[model samples]
Target: MNKFLEQALLFDFYGELLTDHQKEIYEQFALEDLSLSEIAEMKGISRQGVHDLVKRCQKTLEGYEMKLHLVEKFLSVKEKVSKIDDTLAEWECEKNDPEEMVKRIRKIADAIIEEL
Candidate 1:
């Protein structure tokens, strides 16, 4: 996964655990695409302070992921759904037996739901 996307996912999964101040700074840096200097200026802190806070936020979010694995599970489910979609598309192209295809799709869907 892309680094930014990975960070975004981590944040999405665990951002609420952060303090409001931490969340605001992280959102500015990660989501709003602000430079460290820009965030420092906006937050009335030194650039290094903003950098340290952002790093701490990243570590905290990653720690949550390591313990909870919510993001990992979410990504796994997403991949499985994509596979189900691809299987259906293949069935459509092949024009195979409808009943058998339905059974296969149902099995895949069931597995996905079970994982959830």
Candidate 2:
């Protein structure tokens, strides 16, 4: 994944666990695309301080993902759903046998249930 996108995903999944200050700085730097110097000046902190806070927030968010795997599970489930959609579209276009399509859908559904 793109670095910014990964950061955004981690933040989306675990940002609530961060402190208010951390959230503000992270939102400015990562989400709002502010420069470190700009964030520093706005927050009345040194540029280095702003940078460190953003890095700390990143580490904290990644740690949460490592332990809980909520983001991982969400992505997996989303992919499975997309595959199911693709199968349905293919069935519609090709007019494949209904019994085979049912079996395929059941298999995917079973895997999703197992994961949950």
lDDT of each: 0.91, 0.93
Q: lDDT of candidate 2 vs native?
A: 0.93
Scanning candidate 2 in windows of ten residues, the lowest lDDT window is: 1-10
Candidate 2 RMSD to the real structure: 1.1
Model 2, span 6-101: residue lDDT tens: 888888989999999999899888889999999999999999999899989998999999999998998999899999999999999999798999
What candidate 1 gets wrong by more than 4 Å, as runs, is none
The deviation in Å at residue 38 for candidate 2 is 1.7
Give the poorly placed runs of model 2, Cα more than 4 Å off. none
Residue 32 local lDDT, model 2: 91
Backbone clash pairs for candidate 2 read: none
